[model samples]
Structure formats: C-alpha cells, structure tokens
Target: MSLEQSSIRDAAIKAPGRRSPAANAPSLESLVSTARALVPRLRERGQQTEIERRVSEETNQLFHRAGFFRLMQPARYGGYEYGFTALLDVISEIGRGCTSSAWACSLGTIHQWLLGLFPAQAQDDVWGKNPRAIMCGSYSPITAAEAVDGGYLIRGKWRFASNVDNSPWAVLGVQLPEENGAGFLLAPRCDWSIEDDWHVAGQAGTGSKTVVIDKPTFVPGHRKLTFAEAASGAPPGAAVNPNPLYSIPFLSAIPVCLVAPLLGTAQGAIDAFVELCENRVTRGGIGGAGARLGQFAHVQSRLADAAAAVDAARLVLDRDITDVELTAAQGRRVSVETRIRNRRGHAYAAKLSHSAVQALFSCVGGSSLALDQPVQRMWRDANAIAQHITLNWDAVSTMVGQHMLGLEPKGAY
Candidate 1:
C-alpha cells in the first residue's frame, strides 16, 4: 500500500451512536415518528406519485428537511449515525403509505452508510461541499473501465439507477477482472446523463431510469471500492469513520434496506384491506349485495394467513439485524455461515412479504385489477421488489441451500 493509503487507514478517532447529532438535530425516535406522521400525506399523494412516474420533488424535499436521509449517515458529516434498526423503522413506515417514496428514501439513506465504506478522499469529494448530497447506483456490472493515469476511464450505459433525479453522484459497477476485482466506480453528476425511460407495469414511481456515460469519463482511484473490499468488514473507511456499524460485512446486512420496504408495504396493504373488509359487500350473486366481506370464512382465512406471514417476515428480519449489530459491536468478523444465513433471511422475508401482498390483492376480487386502489399498487410494488437481483429468491435460496447441504455455493455473499 502507498504511504498515503497506509496513513489514511491508520489514523482513527472515536465516534459512536450515542454521540449526539449537531445541536437541534432530530433524534432517532423523532425521525421514525415523523415517518409515521407522514403516512397519511404520502397515501394522499400515492396516485399522483405513481402518475408522475417518479417521487415528486416536494416529497423529496420533505425527506431532506426532515433529516430522514441522515439515518445511517456518518456523524462527522452532519448526520444522525443511526443503525439499521432505525433505518428499518423509518423506511417501512414510509412504505406503508407509498411504496415509491419509501423506496427512494430508503436508498438515499442506506447509500450514505455504503459511501462511508469508501476512502476518505472519496467521502470528502461527495459530502464536503454539500453534506446533503445523495448518491444513486447501478451495481450490475455491464460497463468496462480502462486503466488510466490517476484511476480509470469508463464508458457504458447503466440501467435501474434509482432516484437519479435526486442524486448528484452515482457509483456504478465496473469489471476489473484482470485484478480479480469487481469495482464500484463513483461518477460525478456532470459525467453522466439520465434517460427518462423507467416506464414499467410495477414500480413506476421508482424512476429507476437509465444512466448513460457515452463519452469516456475519468474517475480518480480514491472513488472506488471493489466487492471484495466491501465484504472485508473493515474497509478503508472504517479507519476514519470508527463507528462499529462500519465493521459489519457488506452483504450480511445491507440487504435489510431492500427488504424493509417490502415488509412495511405489506403491513400497510393489510391495514388498507382490513378497512375495506369492514364496509365491503358482495354483489350480484347468491350472497347478494348485503353479504359483508369480512364475514366470509374464506376471506377471514386469507387475512389470517397473510397477517401471520407478515409477522413471521418481520421477526426474521429483526433477528438477522440483531445478529449483524451484535457481530459488529463485538468487533468480530461475521462468519460465512452467518453471511449466508442473513442472505437467506433477506430473501425469505421478501418472499413472504410479496406473498402476503398477493393474497390481499387477490381478496379484493375485481378490485385486484384496479389501479386506483392502494392494495393493488402495493401488490405491484411488492412484485417489483421481488424482481430485484439482490432479492431474487430462487437464486438466493439455491445458494444458501447449497451451503446448508455442504456443497459449494456460488455468487452473492
């Protein structure tokens, strides 16, 4: 390692979650409760959020001003330095009201934690000028990076760069196979352009449009972290950040960010459907218009099953988060066994949430096909979440199952 890199990794300081935020900064409870309070307003805006095919700028400003984006940001950067637990609580509540808004906010907060894994120079390049600057990324390795003097020259198109409209920087996946590495290269906003082409049947509000870097762009060496380094549980950023949260293995816990929204949206859909049951009635059949939907034994059964599924999913997620936090606090490397186990938990929780949303959406009868209903939108968003590569059940399940059976598991964690 270069002297500069060694010095960067050796100098450390003390900072913990207990360290209070800047005077008057919102507390963890305040952030979460604020999220709960925003539910009604988000619900009111859900249809419009969907119609716009992106999170409205008004809603984005609400999060920024509320400090919702600082949940996992490093304390030194004028942030709250809260935990994954805090992240889960806040994002899920937002998801309960509107999946798109919740999703956009979730990525925004989690990436702060992710960026804290980079070298200090990279962190400074981003937050020094504007601490509130947010980052979006596309981690599907479709790009080529040619080695250059200072760092690399990259040119490619990346898709599903979520919340690009709100981000000033992006970290894209690049292959460095010659070095046996898979890298995330950070690009300034000026280096890339957005393509407004995120139209989809579900998750229309995510605005996960394409990010294009048609011309070669130079990325400094500091603005990169390979997947291997991220999984180390002690990347370069750990030296400076000093928070135990930075010690946790990357893949072991970050998936929680992706799944928490699913859990919240499922719970929210359940809430919506239960209210619908209280007044909804059958029509044009033997039961006639007077038949109360809630009184039907089949409907009751579906509701019960779905509620149980959601609860089980939450328990799994909570258990894994606790394990990750404990491991980090103890300053121990998360075992391969634990990493795969957490991977299983993340994927299984998503499966359960998606299943629950489908059941409730089905219970709505013709309402299932209706776009105006929140339950239908929740179902669609849940499906979209399930489709994400990081949350894919078939792949994750098989990989974990292989490890459980004493076989060679491959890809992801």
Candidate 2:
C-alpha cells in the first residue's frame, strides 16, 4: 500500500470519536465591545510591540484570557464558533489601536477556524489537550516532503510566519511530490525552529519571522489538509463538525481576512489626521500661519475624500461578508464567479484604504514623518498590509479580468 494510504489506515485504527460539548456561544456584540475596550492597551503597547518585532507576551495572554482565540473555534473545543464577520469586526476594532496587534490576533485565531476544517483526528490532536491553543502558519508551499511509512518526512524553511513565537502549533504549507499538488501539514512547536528574521518598516510588531524545519519531520495523514479540499471548503472535519461556518471557501474567506486590518489601519490614519488638524496650527502654508490645519479648504477636501474612500471600503467588505455567510448557511458552495467577485472586492478595498491613508499622510506634513506619530505608523502599516500578495490590487484585478475573459485565473485564489 502507498505510504499515504497506510497512514490513513493507521489513523483510522486509533481515531478518537470525541463529542464536543454544548455550544457556549458568545454574542458578537459582546466580543466587539471587548475588542473596542482593548484599543487603549493595544495602542499603548504599539511602540513596544514594534521595537520588539512582536506583540508582547503579556498582550498575547490578555487576548487569550479574553476568549479572542476562541472566536471561531469549534463549540466542542470551547470555541464560540462566531460568524465569519465577527472576526472582521473584532480585528478592525483592535486594528484601530495597533495594526500589528490586530494582525497577530487575527491570524492566530483564524488558524483556529482553519483547524475546524481539518479532519476530526487533527482537531482532536491539537484541541484535545488545550482547546485554546493558538496556531501560526506560512501557507505558501516552500517545503519539501518525502513519503514515509505513515506520513511524509518534510524539510524546509517557511518565512513570513506571523506570530510564530506566540504559537504552539503551526500549519506549514508543502508541495506533495507524488500528487504534484499542495497540502498543509500540522506540526507541533518541537518539530520546528524559529529564525528571527522579521525586520521591516511597517507591521514590524507582527513578528513574522522564518520557521525552519531542518530535520525530516514526520506528519501523519490525518494531519494533512489538501489545497483542493481547503479551496473547496469541504474538509473532512466539516463532515463531522457539521457547521456552516466552515463551509466558506478558504480563498474567498482569506482575502477578506487580509483586508480587514488594512481597513482599520486606514481609519486609524484618518482619525489621527483629523485630531491633528483640529489642534495643530500651521506655521506657514496656503492656510497661513496661526490657522488650524482643519480650517484650510485643501485639508477639508482631502479629509472628505479620505473619509469617503474609507467608508466605501468598509461597505464593500460588509457586503462580501454578508454574502459569504448567507451562502455558507444555505450549505451552497461559493461559485467561482462569486469567488472572483470577492477577490476583486477584497483587493479593491485595500487599494481604497491605502489611498485614504496616503491622502491623510500627505497633509500631515513633516511632523507626521516622526516615528512616534500615530498617523505615520498607520500610514506605514496600511501600505505594508496592502502590499500583501493576497490583497495586491494589480494582481487581483488581473485575475478577475482573466476570469471575465474566460481564461483560467492565475494563482490559488
């Protein structure tokens, strides 16, 4: 028998038919409120988080205790199984305070939701010991794997694994040699090593460093999640978990996740700019010395444009989220046409957000260039997030255009 098939048999032999407890659902409103309350702490820690190139351990624990990690987890595993939109709401709230904090929090918890789409055995493997276990990942398939007795022995280095230091489990993307396709393997913290390589101008606090697997690490079959399965939103665990929340296509859902932080970061930039304009008097400019920057017609026009752009992005995001949720609840697969539309919307939202942040940053003048300025930080973070491959406007726009022209869209989305 093939090694993959044998691994499946072995897992079946030891499969634990665990039953989850009754749902302890948390209201979305309460979660949003809790997230909003943490903005002050998040903002206070922003500089420190950036200096350390990671969210503080204290802040990580605080978020854990607040049940933020359980927002999308399975009910049996102590997760609230909140709707998909709940993540956007909470992440955006925290993001208004600090983009990196929101990025780490959002990525970490979203992995919990991703775990819900794995086989029940994989779910039980991680959550059995600690239901609130946080997960980190680098989903690009840069690793090499060899078929072994019961699984694959994988060796490679994965970069851009955000929040790796704060996580006990990682989902490493791999290229399946035999199948000539991609899959993700779940590895415990002990199987891999972390390399401190996250150095960047924006979102530096994300601690998105390299996760190295130098030795051949064994990954069992039950722990493997195929790209095709994830893209289809019909993972094995969905059959057992029976939740519509897990049914959303991974690509459609993930593009939105990438844009959520950018949305909030843009809003943060706007808020900071508005406050500065209200209080700071320009030394000399078109508005003249001793005049509040807010009083200038130029400033007013730019602010209005930025505000409108931000509002438009949020509206687009909200509409996509609602559509995905309704489609999932109806137990219908998201059509390729809809997925393409979502990809376009997600990337366009980032474009709008980046434009808004840039507009506000331009008027903030030389003082905004200071590292300590919140508006500048927001500007940097917004641009950085927009550059992410998932949300890059040019790439996504081309993909949508390709689909519209009856050409196979390039890339996984």
Candidate 3:
C-alpha cells in the first residue's frame, strides 16, 4: 500500500466507534411499535406510491414524526443509535405493507448510518443545522472528480439514487482523477439537477430518479470517503462518532441493508396468499361444494414451501448482521473472509426470499394478477430487488466458492 493509504487505514482502525456523552434517544421498542403501526397505512398507500413513482409526502412525514429515520443515526446528533438489526426489522415490517415504500424508507434511513462515516465537519455540514436531514446515494462510480485546491471538482450524472427526492444532500460515487481508488463525493441537493426519469415495473415508489450535476461542483476534502477506507471496516467518522454501528464493513452492510425489504416483500406475499386461500373457495373441485382453497394439497404445499424459504432467508440474514455487529462491539475489524461470507449469505437470503415470493405468487391464482392485488405487487417488487448487483446470487455464490477454494474472492463484494 502507498504511504498515504497506509496512514488512512491506520487512522481508521485506531479510533473506531467511540461513544460520546450520553444523549436521550428514543427506545427501540417505541420505534418498533411506531413502525408496526404504520404498516397498514403503507399497504393502503402502496398503489398510490407506485402511481406517483415515489413514496408520498404524507408517508414521509409520518415516518419523520415517528422518528424512523433516527434508528441508525448517531446519538450525539439527536439520533437513537439503535442496533443495526432494529433498522432491518423496521424495513422488513414496512416491506410487509409495501415493498416499494419499504425500499425507499430503507435507503432513505440508512443514509444516516452512511453519514456517520464522513469526517466530523462533513457530518456537521449535514446534521448540524438540521439533525433530521436524510440523504441518498448512487454507489456506481460514474461521476468524474478532478483534484482542486481545497477539495475536488466533481461533475457528472448519477442514476438510480433512491429516495433522493426526500433528501437535502446526496453522495455520488466518483472516480478521483488523481487517486487510484474510487470514493464518494458529497454534494448539496441544490448543486444537482434531478431528472424525473424513474419508471419501472417494480419498486416504482422508490423515486430512484436520475441526479445530474451539470456544472462542476467543488466538494471539500472532508466530504470524500475512499472505497478502500470504507471497505477497510473503519471510516474517518468512527474517530468522532465511535459507534459500533459505523464500524461494520461498508460492502457487507450494503447488501444487508438492501435485503431487508426483499425479505418483507416475501413475507407480504405469504400473508396475502394465505388470506386469499382462507377466504376463497374452489368454484368446483373434487372436494365438493364449500371447499376452501386453503384445504387444497397444492395450496398447502406451496404455502409450506414459501414459508420455509422466508424463514431460512431471515435466519441467514439475521445471523450475518448479528455477527457483524458483534465484531464491531468487540472493536475488531471483520476479516475479508467473513465479509465475503456475509455478502454471499445476504445475497443467498435475498435469492431465497425471491423464491418464496415467486412460490406464493404462483399459487395466488389468476385473479390475484390484477394490478391492485398485493400479491402481484409483491411479486414484481421482489423480482426487481433481486436484480440489484449486491444481491446477484449467481455472482456472489461464485465469489464465495472461489474463497472457499483458497482463491482470493473476486469482484467488489
């Protein structure tokens, strides 16, 4: 490693997750209760969110009032500083109502955790004036950055920035012209022009439109986070924030955060399918009149399969996050082996969740294909989520296999 790179890594590891003066934060139980209470409303608004191609303002306000976005934020900044699993649970529950809404919420809220990785001044630039501030991101290195006097001149367009509509600022992944590694550049919302181009078959409510920075914008040095540093399992922010939450491997956490909504999507499918099966009777069948579809062997078997898949997926995901959190609590960095394993496990869980949704969808019958039917929506959302690169089962599985064979795992995990 270069001298600078070595220094960066050393600095990150030395001061990780240091806690600050205790701040009065919301209890996890209350936060969870609020999330549960919002499920029905989210489900009711699912179609509307989809129709609008973004999560509704009303729903956003409800979340803000409920303090849902504060789950992963630093306690020093008026955040709850709750366990990472709590956010996952909240997203999963919300997903049970609307996957698209859950997707937007998860991305929107997780940005708080990401902000904790930036330098203290950068965090201040964001939460100092308004602690309720939320942010969004596009992690692909499509933007260009030129080294300048105070910082770097960044200019480019980034797409698929979920929930950017609800954010005051955004982090765009960029390739630094002077550096060998890629990093993210933080820019205020005013610096970029948003393009309302998001139209998709699934997860449509996420408002993942294009964000364009037409003119070169200067980003200060403190606002940049190198991929190597982020992936190193410690970041510059850890020095000040000192929360185990920020010490989790950035790559590993990425997949985990994205997978929660998919799990909830599958669970929602199961819920809808079971309700349909219980209420609907076969028009004419071998069992005779008044025979419910729930009694059918096919329906029973499919439900069993779907439920099992979701259960297994949740177990895998929960275990991965728990292990990561435990390592951070111990002030230890997660090994590359463990990081790859967790990434692979997360993708596999997502694949399982997708399978569960597919299974439930297949058994939901013809009428459930209607646009308003929750089952159909879950199916579409699940498939769309499965398409994310972090949750690509085939690629992640191969990477895990290569690692098992004593070969260095390939690709950006």
Candidate 4:
C-alpha cells in the first residue's frame, strides 16, 4: 500500500470520541446587536485593518468578546443555536462600515458552523479543548485522498483560504476515488499546512492564502464527511448536534454566508458617500459642490435608488434566512426551489450593491477618485466582492431560472 493509504489506515484506527463542555453561552441575537453597535468603531479602524493586511487585533478581540463565532456552534458546547439570518445581520452590519474587516470576521466566524457539520470526532479534536478557537477553510477539491483501513490519506493544495492567519484549525475539501464513483471529503486542519500566498487588489486584508498538504495525512473514519452524506441531508453531526439548523443543505447556507459581507460593505459605501456629499465644495463653479450635490435631481435619484437596492437586498436575505430557520425549527428539509431562490436573492443583492456603489461614486465627481478617499475604497471593495463566483450574475441567475422553469439546477445549489 502507498503512504497515503497508510495514513488513512492510521487515522481510522485512532478514532476518538466527540468532545464538549457544558459552559454558559451568549445569545445570537445579542451578538448581532453588539456587532451593529460596533460598526462606528469598526469604521474608525477600517484604514488600520487594511494597513495590517488582516483585521486589527482590537477588532478581532471585540468580535470574540461578542461571541460572533458561536452563532452556529453546537449548543452542547458554549454556543447559541441560531441559524443563518443572525449571521447575515452581523456580517451585513460589519460590512456596511468596513468591507474587509467584515469579510474577515464573516469568514472566521462561519467556519464554526461548517465545523459543526463534520464527524463528531473531528469536531471534538477542534472544539473539545477550546470552544472559542476558530477554524478557517477553503472548499476546493484540489487534493486527492485514498481510502484505507479506518480513514483516508489526503493530499492536495487548497487556494483562497481566508483568515488563516487568525485560525488554529482549517477544514478543506478533498476527493477520493471509490469503486462505485468518486467521493468528496471534508477533512480537518491537522492534515494540511498553510501557504502564505494571499495577494489581491481589494479586500487585501482578508489574508486569503493557499493551504498546502504534501504527501498524505491521516484522517480517521469518524473525521471524514462525504458529499453524498451532505447531499442526503445527513451530516455526521446530526446524531450528536440534534439541531435542524445543522441539517440544512450545505450548498444553500454556505454561499449565503460567503456573500453576505458584501451587503455590509455596500452600506458602508453609501454612508461614506453621503457624508462626503454633505461637506464637499464645488471648486471654480457658480454654486458650491455641497449645494449642487444636494440640489441635483440626478444625485437625489441615485441615492434613493441605491438605498432602495440595499434595503431590497436585505429584505431578500432576511426572508431566505427566515425560511431556513423556520424549516429547521419544524424539522423538515428545505426544498431545492427555496435554495435556488435564496441563491438568486444573494446574487441579486451583490449585483445591486455594485451598482449602488458605482452610482454613488459617479456623483462624487473626480475628487472622490483619490486613493485616500473612503468612497474610492468602498467602490473598489464592492467591485471585488462582485467578482466572486458565488455572486456571479450568470450562474446564480441561470440557476434560479432553471429551477423556476422546472429544469435541473447545476453546480453547488
């Protein structure tokens, strides 16, 4: 047998029990409220977060104190069993003030939810010792795993691992060749090494790097989760977590969380643009820039439209999250149509946010184009977020149309 297979065998042999500590936890609603209240402070630190190429240590500590990471963690540990809506609200609020900070926090916090979907033993190894410890992840199946006695030996490199600088653990996507077909696996952070390769134009502080796993690392049977299991709506954590929220389809919830931060970023842009408009003076013109800015029908129209777009997007997000939460509470599977529609809503929001930023920037005139201007930063961040595959207009719009017309959806919906 190969070294990969050997590692798999070792992992299977060392299956460990799931771990949990009965500690007091904060409520998810309260966490959202606190996050909203912190937006002004986060906005003040936005430049600092960008300069550090990661969220400021102070901001991170603040979020941790607010229990932002425990929104989706299993209640058996010190976590509130809230669904996707609360997370959406928190991310949106943060993004509204500082896009990059919001993105980092959102990425760092949501990994806890994903971790809860792993096998109990895998969850134990991560949260058993420190429930507050966070995990960062990337779900690209760039690596391969070979099955052996108790588990599989995994080897591959996953790119775009966000917030890895702050995380002690990671979960990655791997593919294993099987007799019947191929199996997609979710494995723990211990099996891989992180590569510092994050370089990007906007949201530079996200620290989205490459996670490298050379040769093979052992992942025990209990620690492995397959795409088939996820598709069946029977994740390994089901027996232990016993929460319907954990049972929701992975595709539906994952993308929603991934893109929600952009909504917050768009809000931040609007706020900044409005503030600039209020103080800016038109140079070498008959009327002052502020007076013209306020008086122009075009400016008023654009602001109204942008505000409406952001609000509409928020409504869609709220509605979709409510569906997920209600369905989970009722102990029923969320329909594919609902998931597809939710994806559509998310994509639409992203598109609208980009447009809103563009509209606001256009009204700000040439002076706002300076790199130092907050409006310019918001514009750049909004465009960057729009480029994400999950927010791809073509894919999401097409998927929703296909589902609506009684056609099968493609990709991870």
Question: Per-residue alpha-carbon lDDT of model 2 for 77-135, expressed as tens digits?
Answer: 87877655777777888888899998999998889988998999999989899887888
CA-lDDT, candidates in order: 0.84, 0.83, 0.82, 0.73
TM-score of each: 0.93, 0.93, 0.92, 0.88
Evaluated at residue 343, the lDDT of candidate 3 is: 87
Candidate 3 lDDT over residue span 336-372, tens digit each: 8788888888899999999998887786667888888
In angstroms, how far off is 61's CA in candidate 2? 1.3
| Candidate 1 local lDDT, residue 345 | 91
- Alpha-carbon runs more than 4 Å astray in model 3: 1-23, 284-290
RMSD of each: 7.6, 9.5, 7.2, 10.5
The candidate, 1 or 2, that scores higher on lDDT is 1
Among these predictions, the greatest lDDT belongs to 1
* lDDT (10s digit) by residue, model 1, range 18-78: 2334464676667778999999899889888888898888999999988988777888888
- N/CA/C clash count, model 4: 6
> Can you list the residue pairs that collide in candidate 3?
17-242, 17-243, 18-242
User: lDDT tens string, model 4, 1-413?
Assistant: 45754554443222111111224645445666788888888777766666676776677778788877777688877776666776776788878778887887888777777777777877888889988888777776666678888888877788887777777777777776673333344445566677876666788777777777787777776766676666556788788888777788777667767677888877888888788767766673565533646567888888888898787676666666666656766777888777777788778878987888888888878888776677787888888888888888988888777777888877567
Model 2 reaches what TM-score against the true structure?
Answer: 0.93
